[model samples]
Target: MIKLANYTQGQWQEGTGPGTTLYDPVLGTALASVDAGGLDMAACYDWARTQGGTALRALSYAERAALLKQIGQVLQDNRDKYYDISLQNSGTVQNDTAVDVDGAIYTLSYYAKLGGKLPAHVHLEGESQGLARDNAFASQHIEVPARGVALLINAFNFPSWGLWEKAAPALLSGVPIVVKPASATAWLTHEMVKDVIEANILPAGALSIVCGRPEGLLDALNALDMVSFTGSADTAASLRGHRRIQHDGVRFNAETDSVNSALLGPDDSDAAADLLVREVVRELTIKSGQKCTAIRRIFVPESRYEAIAGAIAAKLKTITVGDPRKPEVRMGSLVSRQQHEAILAGIAQLSHHCEILFNGSTEITIQAEAGSACVAPMLFGAKDPDTNPLVHQVEVFGPVATLMPYRDTEHAFELVRRGMGSLVASVYSEDPQFMAQAAIRLAESHGRVHLVNTEVAKVQTGHGNAMPQSNHGGPGRAGGGEELGGLRALKFYHRTAAIQASPDILNRLIQNAE
Candidate 1:
C-alpha cells in the first residue's frame, strides 16, 4: 500500500506500525494508508517558530510573496497528478476536481501578485500621533506577523483548495503553518505538499502536512499560536472547549456547516426560471453538492412555484451518476462509504418534511463495483418552511436541495433567514427593486448576498463559487469567522501594536531600508 508521511522539521517523517487504509470511492478498492503515530508535536512546532519563522521574518512582504508564486508554479506543473488522485480518492470528475486544484493555484497566484505592492515587515494602521508638545516623541499604530506558528485543520471536501486558501494568507503575512488534512481525502493534499517540499521552494518547517489522526495537535499550540479549521459545527464546538483555546487564548477561526440558500425574485419570467434552474443544477452536481456553500434551501415566489420547481426537477434528471473515470459521467460518488451512509440517513429524515420533486434512480449509468458510493442528485419541496424545521436546521451535505414557496418578498426573506446563518444567499430576478431588497434583507443572515439578474446571469460566478477577493465565512451556525477577503485575511495571522517613539524613529519603521 502507498504510505503517506508527514513533512516537518525539514524532512519526510513516516509514522510507525499499521495505519488506516484509504479506499477508492468508485471501486471500493484499497488505495493507500496514512499514519500520525510516534511523532514529536512539540519539536515540530519549535522548528516552525524558530527556524522557519526566523527565515520568513527576515524577508520583506514582497520577497515572501515571490515564494508563493514559486509554490503556485510547482502545483501548476503537477496539476494532472492531483487530478488523477482526486478521481481515485475523491471520486470526482475532471470538472469537479478543477475547482479544488485550479482554485488553489489561483489563490496562491493572487496573493503573490498582490503582495508585490505591500511594505516589508510592518503595516501602519493609521497616521502618526503626537505624544509630546515638544515634538520629541510620537506614536504609530502598526501591524506585524505574530511570533507563534499557525495550525490549519482542513475538511474532507476540496482538500487542495482548503489547504491553499488558509496557507496563502498565513505565509504571505510571514507566519509558518502546519496543515492537518482530513484523513479520508488527504492524498491530493499530501501530493501537493510533497511537490512543494521536494522543489525546496519554501524554507525548512515553513509548511508541514500531518496526515491521519490529530491527537494532541491542539495541546502543542501556545497562546501566540493560531488555528484555522474547516469542518462540522460539533467539532468546532469541541475544539473551542480545548483548554488551550479556552484558557490560553489560542486564536481560533472556523468555517463550519452552512445551509446556504438561493431565492428566485418576484419576477416570474421564463428566462429567470431557466437561469435559476441552470445554476441550482450546477450547484447540486458540482462537487456532488458536498460544498459548505452549496444551496440547500431554495425559495421561489408562490405564483411561480409550480413552474420553477418543475424546471429544476427536470434539469436534475439529466445528471449522469457513475464512476468519474467514465467520460460520459457528469457526477460521481461521495468521498467515502461512511459519508455515503450518513447522507442516505440524512435523506431519509429530510423526506419526512418535504415531498419528493425528483427521486433519481439508484442504477449507475456506467458499470462499476456494487459497493461504489455513487448517488444522483435529488430535489424536494416544502410547502410550509416554518413548520418543517429540519429543512433549515439539518444540512444533508450531499446532492440534495429543498424548494419552498413564498407568499411575497418578505416571506421569502423570513424563510431564508430561518436557516440562522449561511455562507451565501443568491437572488435571481430581473426585478431591480426585489433584488435590491433581497440583498439588503439577506445580508442580515448571510456573509454574502449575491444578486443575479439577467444581465449578470451570464457572468456572475455561480452561487457555490467562493472567490478569493470576497470573504468566505459567515456568522452564528456558520462559525462567525472570516477568511479570503483579498489581503484582509493577513490580519488574522498578524498582531497590531502601537509603537511609541520619536518622530524620526516612527518614520523609519514604515518600510524596508528606510
Candidate 2:
C-alpha cells in the first residue's frame, strides 16, 4: 500500500513508523496508510510563516489570485486521475466525487476572478472620518492580510472541497496554508496537493498537508496563525479550548455538524411538496448524507405530514446503493468501517424517538464484493417534535433523516429553533407572506434560509449545495463561524486597522498600496 506523506518544509516527508491503514469502505481493502510520527510540527509552522507567508505577503492580491488560477488549472488537468483515488479512498460514486473535486476547482476559479476587484493589500472599510475639528486630520479603516498561516483541520467528507474552499480565500488574502486532512480519506486531498506541488505553481511553503495523527499540529501554531475546522461539535469545543486558541490569541473558525431542519409552509402547494421531496432525497443520497448542511430533522405541517412522508419514501426507494464503480449505483458506502458502525449507532439512537417511515437497510444490494459498511437509505418520522429533544439534539451523519410534524406556523418555527442552530434550513412554499415570515424566523437560527416555489424549482441549487456566493456556517452548535460568501470569506484571514492621518496622506497611501 502507498504510505501517505506530509508535505512540509518545502518537500514531501513521511513518518518514522508504521501508522493507521486507510481502507476502502467497499471491499475492505487497504488503499494507503499515514503517519506523522517523525515530522517536526514547530518547524513546519515556522517554515510556512517565514517562507510561504513572506513570499505571499510580498505579492498583491491580484497576483495571488493569478496563482490560484494556475493551481486550479493544474487540478483541472489532472482531474480524471483523481476519480479512481476518490472511489478507493472515499467510497463515493463518480458524481459525488465530482461534487468534491470539481467543486474545489470551481471555488478556486471563482476566487481567482473575484480577487481582480480587490486592491493590492489595503481595502478601505469605509469613507475617511474627520478625527480633528479641521478637515486636515482624518482616520480610515483598512483591511490587510493577517501575516499568518491558514491551518485547516478538515473532516472526512469533501476532502477536496473543504480544503480548497478554505484555502482559496486564505491564499487570496495573502495567507499561506497548512492542511491536516482526516486520515480516513486523505488520499484524494494528498494527491491534489501533490499535483499542485509538482506543477510548481505555488511558492515554497505556500501550501502544506500533514496526514495521520495531528499530535503537535495545534501546538506548532502561535498567535499569528489561524485555524478553520469542519467536524463535530465536540471536536470544535476541544479545539476552541486549546491554549493557542484561548490564550495565545490564535484565530479559529469551525463548521461543525448540526441537526439541520427543513420546514414546509402551512399552505403548501403540490408543486412545493414535489420540490421538497426531491431535494430531501437528493440530500440523503448525495455523498450518503454525510454533508454538514444535510437535512437531518425535517418539519412538515401536521395536516400534510403523511402525504409528504409517503412521497419522500417512494422517491428514496428508487436510489441504487452499491459500488461506486458501477454506472447504476447512485449511492455508495460510508468512508470506513468506523463510520459505518457510528452511522448504525446513530440510527439506533434516533430510532428510540422516531418510528421508521421507510427502512432501506435490508434492501441494500451491492453490485461488487464489499464489506459491512454499505448501508441503504432509511427514513424515520417523529409524531411530536417539540417534546423529543433527542431528535433535535442528535445528528445522525448518514443517508438518514427524520420527518417531524408541527402544529402550525409558530410550532414549526419553534421546532426548527429547537435545533439551536443550523447551516441551512429549507422552506418550501409559494405564499409571499409565509415565505417572507419564514425567512425572518428561520434566519434567526440558520445561516441560510432557502425559500423554494415552482418558479425556481428547477433552477434552485439543491439545499445541501453550498454555493460560492453565499455564507456556509451557523451559530450555536453549528460552530458560530461563517465561510465562503464571495469575498466575505477573506475576512477571517484579514486584519483590520484604522489609520489616522491627513486626508491627502490617506489618499496617497491608498494610491500607493500596490
Candidate 3:
C-alpha cells in the first residue's frame, strides 16, 4: 500500500494520528490508508504566509508559469501511476483519470499561454487623455497578485484538476498556495504534489497541503489571505461568513453544484437526435454522473418528449456498470457507501417531486461484488418544463437526469432559468438566431453556457462539464460565486488599488510593487 504524505515548507512529513483507508470504487476494497491528524495548522499557515508567499511573489508571472509547465509535464510523464492511484478513489476510469491528472498539467500549459496574451501590469487599458498639444497619455492597466495566501479548498470529484485549475493561476499571479483537497480523495492530489516536489519544479514554501479538517484555520487568517472553495453552497456560505474573513475583507470565491441543464435542437433530424441521446447517456454514466457540471435537467419540446425519452432510455440501458478497470464497464461505482447513500437520498427527493421515467433499471441488473455499492444511469421525465416543480429544485448528483418538455424557444429559456442559477447550461441548435437567443438569456442565470449543434456537437463539450478556461459557479443556488476563469482567478488572490501618478512615479511604483 502506498502511503500519502503532506508537502509542507518543501519537506515531506508523516502524521502522528492513525490513517484513514482509501478504497477502490469497484468492490469497496481498501487500497491505501492516509494519515490526516496531528499536524500544526498554525505553523502551516505561517509557513505559507512568510516563506511561501514571499518566495512566490518574488518570481515574475512568466517565471512562475514556467515552473507550472514543468510540473504539468512531469505529471504527464507519470500519468500511469496517477491512474493507478486514482482508481482507488472510485468513478475513475482511464479517460476520467486523464482528464483529472493530464487535464491539470494542460491547465498549466494554458496558463503559460494566457501569460503571453495578457498584460504584465496590474491594470487594464483605460481611456486616453490629452496631456498637451501633440502629446497624449494612454492609460493601460494590469493586475497584480495579492500579497497574501490563496487557500484552495477543493472538491472530492476531479481532485487534481480542481486544485490545479486554481493553483496554476494563483501561482502564476505570484501568490503562494495552501491547498486543502477534499478529505475523500486527497491522496491523488498528494501524489501529484509529491511529483512536483521531487521534480524540484517550485520554490520551497510556494505550496503546502493540509490532509484533514481545517478547524480554526480560517479564524486565524489575515486580510491578505484569500480563499477559493469548491463544494456545497451551504458550506461556502459558512466559510464566507467567518468572523475574520467577513470583518477583515478576506477574498472569497466559491464553485458550488447546482441544477445544470441542456436543451435539444428543435430542427435536429432523427440521426441528430440519436447523437444527442448518446451524449446524454455518456454524461449520465461517466464518473457515475458525480460531476458538478453534469446535466441534471434536460429540456425538450413537448411534442417530442416521447421520442427523446425513448432514445435516451435505450442508450442508458446499454451502459455497463462495475469496476472502472474492466474493459467492458462503461461506468464505475460511486466514491463510497456514504456517497452512494447521499445519491440515493437525492434520488428519493426527486421521486417525491417528479415522476420517474427511467429508474436506472439496468444498474441493478449487474451483480455487485461483496461490499460494493452501485447504481446504473437513471432518467426521469417531467412533462412540462415550465410547470414541473421538481425539475429545477432537485439534483440527484448521480447518473440521473430529469427530462422536461418546453412549448417553444421562449418556454425553453424559461425552463432553463428555472434552475435559478447554474454552473453551466447547454443548448443544442443549428440556427444562429435560436442559439443566440437561448444563450444570451441563459447566460444571465448561468455562469457558463455551451451552444451545441450538429457542427459543434461532435467536438462539443457535453452539457454538464466546466473546463479550466471557463468560469465555474453561478448566482443563487449554484453557490452565487465563481472560480478558475483564466487570469480572473488570479484576482481572487490579490488586492487592487487605484493609483494616480506621473509616468516616472508610476514606473517607480511598478518597479517596487512586488
Tens-digit lDDT string for candidate 1 (159-220): 99999999999999999999999999989999999999999888887998899874579898
lDDT of candidate 3 over 162-213, digit per residue (tens): 8888888888877888888887787788888877878877777888887766
Q: Which ranges of candidate 3 are over 4 A from the true structure?
A: 1-3, 116-142, 268-272, 362-364, 385-387, 507-514
Clashes of each: 0, 0, 12
Write out the backbone clash pairs for model 2. Answer: none
Ranking by lDDT: 2, 1, 3
Predicted structure with the largest lDDT when compared to the true one: 2
**Candidate 1 lDDT trough over 10 residues, lowest sum:** 360-369
Give candidate 1 regions above 4 Å deviation. 129-139, 362-367, 511-514
Q: Give me the runs in candidate 2 sitting further than 4 Å from their true place.
A: 363-370
Among these predictions, the greatest TM-score belongs to: 2
